[model samples]
Target: MRLVFGLVLIAGVALAGGAVYMARDYIAQYQDQLARERQATKDALANVKSVPTVGVIVTNRAMKYGEPLVKDDVRIVNWPEDAIPEGSFVDMAILFPEDANGERFVLRAVEKDEALMKVKVTKPGQAAGLVSQIEKGMRAFAISVDVSSGVSGFLRPGDSVDVYWTGSVSREFEGGGGEITRLIQTNIELIAVDQIAGSDVTGATIARTVTVAATPEQIAALAQAQNTGQLSLALVGVQDDTVATAVEVDQRKLLNLKESAPAPAPVAEKVCTVNTRRGGEIVKTQIPCTN
Candidate 1:
């Protein structure tokens, strides 16, 4: 019995030693693989050429029209050197020049990560108000409107509309007057609502007056039309670029009057006159003439 117990103990010790050796070998193999992978990554990185870059000022968050451009609203990011945008600001001094009196406003709405350009912002000390938004050779004209005529207050700045005149026309002769509704202006750009020029307004606005940018000729026509009749505005889609030719509708046309066909032009009856053979005295008599 003593011999058998000693033999079993020797076998168990040998088996345990073999298992330990195998575990150590497996761990060392994994460690060597990790070291080799790290070396390969270093070699790959060393061969890549670094791209040249420059600091560019970009909007940190979205900005709406009429909002002032502040230091906190923008930040500098490293942009590729070759693709730097025009009018980009590289430093704080250039962005907010000391002579500007710290008054820089956003001319248009800017989105996140958008680079700031001089054209996108207003001039130094110039407010992003309605006056600044007017286009060259255009005047801002205000017209009265309500919820019914104002597109249910869905109108905002930068939206285009079609103006219509609806009223009866005064005529000098009886039955010459008629009530008509016609499109006076098409694709007119709205520049303001009440006094607000920014479309970032919180609630729906049924502006009592809408200011539109128009040429002098348009302004003159609109002034006369507004006084002659009630002006109604039709909202136009942003993508609607085509101006309708002549959209005029009277009460008769709107009701689709299938009036009688125009009466045929009247034909005059042919009459032949025969001269009497009295010397100096001449008398004429009508006789039936055949075609």
Candidate 2:
């Protein structure tokens, strides 16, 4: 009996140890499975965030193509909550409205290849299109006479003015005669203000100055007018079609005189003769005329 009891006690102890070992193994296996599941969940979340979406606003307009998409401008719609921004630096493809014809539109940002908004191309105080008739080498005349200010130094280079000068105008008449009239150098371009405080007439203060340009003949007339009667500079608008047409007519007349008058007669060449004396007998010999 004593032997049987001892054996039974040993068997019971072995079964308890085996049960403890099994429980430990099962717990370890469960913990490992739980850790793997947590890792998989994290990976899934990262993948979901990486998926691209539509209508995402990109703020950086300077971004080029083929770059990684990043979050910028706000996302609009049709995008997953975890989706990454698409086209962080994409060239926007715009579908302009038909009524917006002739108007320029610049894309500041884009999402899913769609334009977000129009950007301002010009800056403040910047003049667009062609300059307001104020260009280099252009001629202008002073409108007001500011002799005290050296011919109105208050004026500017870009400023437009009306030049008033009086001079005796001499022109060829129809019958080989000439006629003189009071010539006035009206609207003229002011290229430079010589003898003035500064080259630019935009704003200055001087007196008794002279101006120069490509065509100073008109200014010379104005100077003559100043000597005779009164030379005045009138600030006015730019030259229009009418004034340009008159200038063109004057230029055409100066260029083509045949259109204005009849052609002159061709002059005839004179002949000469040489007299030769042969033994007191006079002989006349004709010489060929050369032009």
Write down the RMSD of all candidates, one decimal each: 6.2, 24.0
Could you give me the TM-score of model 2 versus the true structure? 0.25
Can you give the lDDT of residue 88 in candidate 2? 32
lDDT of 2 by residue, 145-181 (tens): 5654234455543344455433333445443223222
State the local distance difference test value for candidate 2. 0.45
In order of appearance, the predictions have TM-scores of 0.70, 0.25
Instruction: Report, for every candidate in turn, its global Cα lDDT versus the true structure.
Output: 0.89, 0.45
> What C-alpha lDDT, on a 0 to 100 scale, does residue 196 get in candidate 1?
82
Could you tell me the lDDT of residue 91 within candidate 2?
34
Return the top candidate by lDDT: 1
Collision count of model 1: 0
Candidate 2 segments exceeding 4 Å error: 1-153, 166-183, 194-204, 214-220, 223-227, 238-291
Model 1 bad stretches (over 4 Å): 1-8, 28-52, 59-73, 80-88, 107-114, 169-177, 241-243, 261-291
